[model samples]
Target chain A: MAKRVGMEVSIAVAEAVKLADADVIAAYPITPQTHIVEHLSELVADGELDAAYIPVESEHSAMSSCIGSSAAGARTFTATSSQGLALMNEMIYIAPVLRTPIVLAIANRALSAPINIWNDHSDIMSVRDTGWLSIFAENGQEALDLTLASFRIAEDPAVCLPISMNIDGFTLSHFIEPILMPEKAEVDKFLPPYKPQLWLDIKNPISIGLLGGPECYTEARKATDDALWGAKRVVIKAFDEFNQVFGRQYHVVETYRHEDAETIIVSMGSISETAMTAIDEMRDQGQKIGLVRLRLWRPFPEEEFLAAVSKAKNLAVIDRHMVMGCSSGPVGLEVKSLVYNSGLRPGISNFLLGLGGRDVTRDDFKYIHEKATSGQVQARCEIVGVFE
Target chain B: MTKPTVDAMAKVGDLPMGFTAKPGSTVAFKTGDWRSVRPVLDREKCIYCGFCYFYCPDGVYQDMGKDEKYYKADLDFCKGCGICAHECPKKAITMTLEEV
Candidate 1:
């Protein structure tokens, strides 16, 4: 059994990265995500971890340096949030195309126009098409566990792709909770030294970045798409192996009291925990309502999601970010698109809630469930807790 | 180009993802076929100044020793951009039409 210690979520993630023995950590400090990079810098400065802690000027350079370091066959890691992720948008796409297995910890935060430094899915949702393996952490233990697992998944020979472990800003990133800290020896047995399959080297010089004309551009894209889809198998295998080695198990779609529910509330991030409390209260009163949490966002887990929600007749999707001028939220849109042809007809009501970390209490979830269950919602999607 | 090198390029199917060759792989890819006009050097009026060598973006001009022939363009890799011809001070180079 691992020793349990109480620590801030961001520090736990940094400790996990330290145990993974990362060769390089290049990052820029941003609100909510600052503690992660700050602790990593201290590890390097205190000689606790032997690695290069590059304090880059901006997130763009941070991701660029991470790409260069990973291409040079180093185990590279970085952390960022909100605008920082937006700044590194160009390099984020390059990491997957170049097959550089760099690990990123994104403290999921709201994007700015009014300049809000709070938790939301807008930052993570913005990079939905960037072709990185995106996963969400519900709590501190998961934030730590997934950080270690990301390196394994990314560096896996079958799945040589970048990964993003999303920690909800201020909610999960700042929350202090008791978590099981695995020993270094236990982690060492699980994750081995990174052996790069393809790399930039001097001795065995090779030319990369060949010109992809119109004739070959589609083919290159096809290959990349195929690789990302194939990564799902490796992701499952890694989770199973992790469970076998360390006693904690995870699924693509985790359910709570959903065995024979008529209505299921779907969600992601830390709010899923709040929804669980709401579901428990609803179930005690025989309301027949349950909860479904999406653990994996990208490589979207369509089959697993369909199977998980198949038992429910109605679904109430809670989205943290609002897609302006859209029919539904991003997650709801994807879920609707996926289940359109599945032949399992179920009414999905999207409730766009918790923008910029708005207070979404148990009563709010109860309201969403009541509205979705009674089919009293006027549109397919509606904003909750807004002044409307 | 060597037979094996050309064979390898032919083996690359529709998608050439991260296709890497030797250090000087660029030498293997001939760009002369893309040229609509070729640089014709009037070596007789040539002054051995290496202006064309410095101006050619493709490194087309090759140094032949300082004895008599100072430099000449390697046409197999030249796109004939006319930079070298435009930069020649002595009017020793001219762009000639490459027939289809």
Candidate 2:
């Protein structure tokens, strides 16, 4: 119980990769994401872990190599930042269509115009429609834990989907902190070396990528579609197993004081910790407030989301990146879609805050919550944090 | 980039031609040889994106001769065989395996 040491989130993520026991680590160098692969590189080099480390030429090839390794039935891992993730965009759809449970760590960074290296949801949001399940981590501890859990959730027999776990770029990964590293024996009992039932093998000699006519295209898509929707239950089962082993409680939608509160702030990734601090401050000042931290974004927790938001009169959902024409932010777009789709009566508002690694303070939360409760949805889409 | 294995590419099977009213088809509705060429679109849940145009060989489908509501293959010229179905990215076209 006392072997705890100061570990950077990036290093913790590397340790989690060891626990996940990934068979292939395909990567290209990119900012904020470089150290994770570097640490993983040392592990593989030192013969501490048995795996193939392919130093791909580009982010596109990093994804391409992982796709091949995954198709050949290997548990694959990789890490990339803004441009690197954007470069592998097309393969994003292909990876899940093949139903490979490849786990990628996104060092959340801003998409370039001015070429910023700051933390933002821009990189992840761009690929939101690619059918990969995305999980967010609030700190280094969760950054380590969620990455391991992601492999389990993604590779579940019922789910078989690709997963992306986002850890804030300069914020969490580089920030040094104390972490309890689990023993290899415990991780071994929890996760087994991946044995794929279906794979691209020469001996089996079966065909994939066969042409399907209108007569059969629907069924292929249907299988992937149904599998994703079914993943909600799959994730819960995997999470339950994970919780029992690790002593951590995770739900589709994690609530803080939502049971008795009149107002709720919905968020994802590292901002949840800041939101909690804000909640504490607001509560001390006699505001009946709470927080809902969303962990999984794909297979968008429909019934659970309704149940969570049903009691709240006022809700403000924060999105780190805008969804362009259709909506302002990705999470904001999702929350609105769920609200409109289910016909739930919560007064949901969209808040586009903490973008490009802007440190969101307690004061920012107080202002957004107050405006949201006063029935101020200030845009054609809900763009929170604007000043006159 | 290394080329995709010619052997792997060679193994993709030819599409079936003309239909049979078999009791064992997974699809509920199948066109059985009446129209000479059967077009099967799987709507198990169709996103309805069209990819069949690029796939058809033999110039069987006239892009536009009369009406273009839906594309059709010239059956008289076609051997009643379905290569279009095999090449279709969406798998929306099916030709029943029939004797030429």
Candidate 3:
């Protein structure tokens, strides 16, 4: 039985992990991500969740231990934020190469120079090429649902790769929302116990993460990339199965009012909700604008994305991380490259906003629409609402 | 038990998932070719102290028991690191460069 209840998003995420019946949780305390692991620790302490909660000294060790546990055929999980994620950088890259399907919850935060702890995409963007299946959650409900689905998606024999579910720090992570938490039995029906295809077994020994010399290195990397590309099918299947069991539909790319629009805004994470409200207001006034929210970040839902924006003449891409020195932000670069390669010549304008915890209002979305439609937006990435 | 051999020239699809290999697969690769210098032992001067046997990094030197006067290097697995010769107390082993 699934019942709607008001709960913090972090706790909901923890509860979802528990329902997945994770065998091991290795994590270090970091802001925003701290609550998720802390609640997990409590769950383990109270005997609500039967899992090993390893309180690691650092994020690096956290991910390393996760790899070790997951290699030993345990359903392993961990959570981290800005600096924590950066610290786990080394192990993060190796996890995917080793085919350790560890589910990681990222409380998306801005990377630091001045050391600010706020919501942004900087943390996730830094490790974008780490070969992990990356997904974004626009709300608390999506966070919970996606976290649970991540286990099924990652541990699938065809897609034995790590996954990172990114939720905006403080915004979606700290917010208490009415999420329909599914019962354990329902979750069990949705996601069965994890059965690894390959593991570090003592009886039947096998070597993983071995040295890939020049003779086989390229093929090894190609195989990993192929596995990631092949994961899209499994992702869709899992989402479809999840919808069947939970009655909540999810897509790699979700659209809002884009059926008959000339201007479309592209965004990810929690800010898409704000953009949606702005789109509705503009629609009421007959502005012919809409939004395309990317729920799946990695292996970049190509066909779905192009279909979502094919009819649109103008695209306002909202990027939360600034790719310094580059012509555009990370997401912006990806979208532009995708559009260019696909031969779609939509006037894509990259807008950088909500960096290091800056507030992104509906008004900002409207302003972006104005710039995009009026053709006043430049070809380069523009930082919106910077105090001049 | 026989170890499975991975074909180095195998295509991306044919390769094992995650570059995994069976245990002791290194036996298929004779690393002795990588050695620039090979150890020559003086069997008559050898005291059978087992110094070369204990110090060989690759476990290249094998003790032939009480019958043999010195530990013999298994060139099939040896990289000719010279560690066995360097650690020999009786100076029974000497490293010599392989002639081209």
> Per-residue lDDT tens digits of candidate 3, residues A1-388?
7999999999999999989999999999999899999999999999999999999999999999999999999999999999999999999989987899999999999898979999999999999998999999999999999999999999999999999999999999999999999998999999988898788888988987788778777787888888998898899999999999999989999999999999999999999999988889989998999899999998789999999999999999989999988989988999999999999998989999999999999999998998998867587998999999
| Two-way lDDT contest, 2 vs 3, winner | 3
Off by over 4 Å in 3: B1-7
Model 3 chain A scores worst on lDDT over the 10 consecutive residues at A208-217
Worst 10 residues of 2 chain A by lDDT: A204-213
The Cα error of candidate 2 at residue A121, in Å, is 0.8
Q: What DockQ does each prediction reach against the true complex?
A: 0.37, 0.03, 0.69
Per-residue error for A274 in candidate 1, Å, reads 0.4
| Overall lDDT per candidate, in order of appearance | 0.86, 0.76, 0.91
Give a tens-digit lDDT track for model 1, residues A210-311: 555555455556666777888888888888888987888988778898889999999998999999999899989989998888888878888888988898
Clashes of each: 0, 16, 0
* lDDT, candidate 2, B1-100, per-residue tens: 0112111112112121101112223233233334455555454523333345455554556554333334555554454457667766656677755445
After TM-score superposition, the amount by which residue B62's alpha carbon in candidate 1 deviates from its true location, in angstroms, is 2.4
Instruction: Give TM-scores for every candidate, taking all chains together and pairing residue i with residue i.
Output: 0.94, 0.79, 0.97
**Which pairs, if any, clash in model 3?**
none
Chain B: TM-scores of all predictions? 0.76, 0.38, 0.85
lDDT of 2: 0.76
Query: What lDDT score is found at residue A197 in candidate 1?
Result: 70
